[model samples]
Target chain A: MRTITKNGVRIDDTFAEAFPMRGTALILTGPNKRWARQAAVTMTGFATSVIGCGCEASIDGEVEARDTPDGRPGVRVLIFAMSSNDLQTQLVNRVGQCVLTSPGSACFSDLVAADALKVGDLLRYFGDGWQISKKFGNRHFWRVPVMDGEFLCEATTGFTKGAVGGGNLLICGADYEKTLRAAEAAVEAMNEVRDAIMPFPGGIVRSGSKVGSKYKALHASTNDAFCPSLRGMTKTALDDDIGCVLEIVIDGLTEAAVADATRAGLAAIIKLGPRNGARRVSAGNYGGKLGPFHFHLKDLLA
Target chain B: MTLVLTLKVTPPQRLDLSVLLPHLLADKSSKDVAAIDLATTREKITVGDLFRIRAGSAEEIRFEGGSERFDGVGQGLQQGRIFVAGDAGINAGRQMTGGDLVISGNVGPYAGSAMTGGRLEILGNAGDFLGAPREGELNGMSGGLLVLRGAAGRRAGDRLRRGTILIEGDAGDWLGSRLIAGTLIVLGRVGVSPGYLMRRGTIVLAKPPALASTFVDCGQFASSFPAVFGRFLLPESRGAARLFRAPLRKFAGDMAVLGKGEIFVPA
Candidate 1:
């Protein structure tokens, strides 16, 4: 199949396959947006992947004061786990340690539907018998009397099957500077698309990994094939002109989410293709051997 | 003034008089209000066959004649006022959310359970769990006010979250047990464990208890009572501004749990 190239950028034929996982979202609010971001960053810390951290979470977006329950600046965080029980455990621990510990901060469940199982109902006993449960409208919230008045958290959280590792695109440029620029542009484009998150440092991954390491103790190692400096020594796939490669991994809750992110990333990269030394943009795949669903880059861009 | 339909005789079996409150009969005329449906001894009876129907507005309702076994007279009434001249049966003013319900005589058990808002003033004695929860429910009397002129049976104002319960006379044991919030003012002596497992809110007692184990004396200070009760407690001619008193004794307790709630015994 002929790969689609837009403005001298190569769109790989392979797709980023994803799998279904249980997910929950939390809303954290404080006196201002700064405190809200503080609590959010702490709550979603060390939650990049389920393989080691037991969950994958990130700040989905920021919410306005009117959208919050207590009329404060807040952020929406989405957490995904392998199962419902694991999701509940990780949520209880993270929320208890991060959001509840923060002064003038309150946590609430973003998902209001009934399917969300409750985790706060059991954790409320930390109030040490002083916890008060209030049912407003159809939602039940627990008021754990803290030092600063009360820490009101939703009694339950709504759960749904969300797509993980959905849309991933790797950028291979003429040099490190060009590759970094291309990846940064792709991240900005993907950020414009809703319902998608690139849960990594700066939305760019320099140390791309394969499924397993050469050593017996490690599960994953660096992708040496994509390394331009070690081209002749190792089984390298990059051409002579391609000097640097950076990966942009995207995960969303639905198929449209992956397609939208892919479209945005491609659009942004193509827009900056002339000035930047960006050579080509491709995708990472294991020959359709990993996750179930896939988002073909060419099909998504078209 | 809504008309009240009083049963002339107390039947052998239990009666359900939940339909006889003023708010339930608010839209009906005085004559039609008196002709409400009643279930007595497994038989349906009309109001015209029982007591007289006086013509008035739906604001006030007066019940007379029957002194034995009248049940659920003002259950779940949200507005208007109800006055029972003689003794009432079981579940009088049960779950009353708003308006006023005044019973001149004694009342049976479970009065004002699950009441979200309203006022229930009983001039005579009351049965068990007055202003308390049903058998298994967790919360009781989230809002509104409940006043008992005479004594009340066990577990009065149990697990109350909001509102005030003022009792002029003595109260039974385990009063205000597991109170979540709100104020319970017992003008008379209270039984043991008055504020058990109380997390927050104030509970004021006029008289002290003989034994003191759970509650710890926090401090003595005054509290401002809300001004809305003057119109309800005093005569109609007097305005609601005259009922201002300060410096109430504040004693915090049920410290065995969180030690946040207070019990103010009048100094």
Candidate 2:
């Protein structure tokens, strides 16, 4: 195959594989956007992965007053868990501790569906004996009387299966600076894409981990094959001219999310390749054996 | 003219008015209010049958019927006006907080029991303990007005805290018993032991009782009747606002307990 390379970097032929996981999204509103963001950030903090954090959660985006049910500024937070039970537990605990405790903040379900069971029924007991429950339409809400006024929280959240580790791509360049620039371009392009998120910090991961570790105590270890400093010491997969590599991991709620993110990310990185010390693009995969999704980079870019 | 509900059938059994309070009927207009679905003897019945409901723009309800056995007629009514064309049943205007209820005819037992803030008026006689506390309630008629046009049954205005009750006709025994801090007026003759065991309320009786054992003779005094009744009974009266302009005599006692509440009678 005739390969496309910008500034002497190779574009790999493979694609990233992703698995399906269940996720839920919550919307938190406050007297203003600042307090809403504060509550949302606290609720989603340390919720990067299900392995360590019991769930993967983050502030998906900011919502305006018109987008909310109560006509207040809100922030949307997406939470992912291994199962329905885990999602419910983490959601209840985080909302009760973080959002409800924040001043003038009210939490409500962003995703409205009939099948979802709510969690606010249990947390409403915090009102002690004075709590009031209201049902509007099909959704139930709890009004916990507080000192300032009332803290209104939705009784339930909605959940659906979403694709995790979707549309991932790797950036390789002549040096670390070029590689980071390419990653940043990819991230910027992927921003605002619907139902998709780059879970790593800045949408790029410098320390990519392999499946298992050589040490008995560790389950996973760093991919030394891609490390520039260890090029001569380990079985290096990078060419001698290749200086740095960065990986972008994506997750989406569906197949379309993965495909759209992949397309945008590739286009952005390709556009920025020559100007930013240039780079080639590739994707991560386990030989099509790990996940159900297989995103072919050539098909995506085309 | 929100919603109106009219009874479709004259209930064979006693009708329950607990569900018909004004606060519960807020969202319904006068027309919709006349269409409330009620259950009688395990069968469904509508409100448009028994009484003719006239749609009014005012946030008040008028019932034109002479049937008795209406219970809890204005229970827990926080606001709005209710007028009964004829006599009422047990517990009429019970536990009312803020509203006006008027019964044109006599009322059954326990009218205006435990009323917190409102005004209730009965043009005819009233049963036992009118404007008194319920059997288990600690507070009684804390803030409201009750006026009876005719005689009252035994123990009228018992245990009242901070409201006013006026009786135009005769009163039964043990009137204003255990009254803490309210006003009770009897424009006609009071039966024996009018102010028995009263703590700190004003009870005015028209004629001095012959027995007069429990109540000490507080001495004769010249006082204007309309001023006395107007101060305590009529101004706040919901449907009987025109009946408070009469002369009265004031007597203070149930000296057997604390000697505070007075009994006022017509001069």
The fnat of each candidate, in order, is 0.00, 0.00
Report iRMS (Å) of candidate 1. Answer: 10.5
lDDT of 1 by residue, B242-261 (tens): 32232345566777887777
All candidates: CA RMSD in angstroms? Answer: 9.9, 16.7
Off by over 4 Å in 2: A1-3, A6-9, A114-117, B1-267
State TM-scores per candidate.
0.64, 0.53
The per-residue C-alpha lDDT of model 1 at residue B34 equals 55
Give the deviation of candidate 1 from the true structure as CA RMSD: 9.9
Tens digits of per-residue lDDT, candidate 2, B1-267, equal 422334444667777766676678766665675576644456655566455566654357666664576777887878888877777788889889888888898889889988877788898899998888887887667777787888899999888887667777888987877887666767677777766777666676556476456555444333222322343333444222233344334455666776655554444
For all predictions in the order shown, the interface RMSD in Å is: 10.5, 22.6
Task: List TM-scores of chain B, every candidate.
Answer: 0.83, 0.80
Interface RMSD of 2: 22.6
lDDT of each: 0.74, 0.71
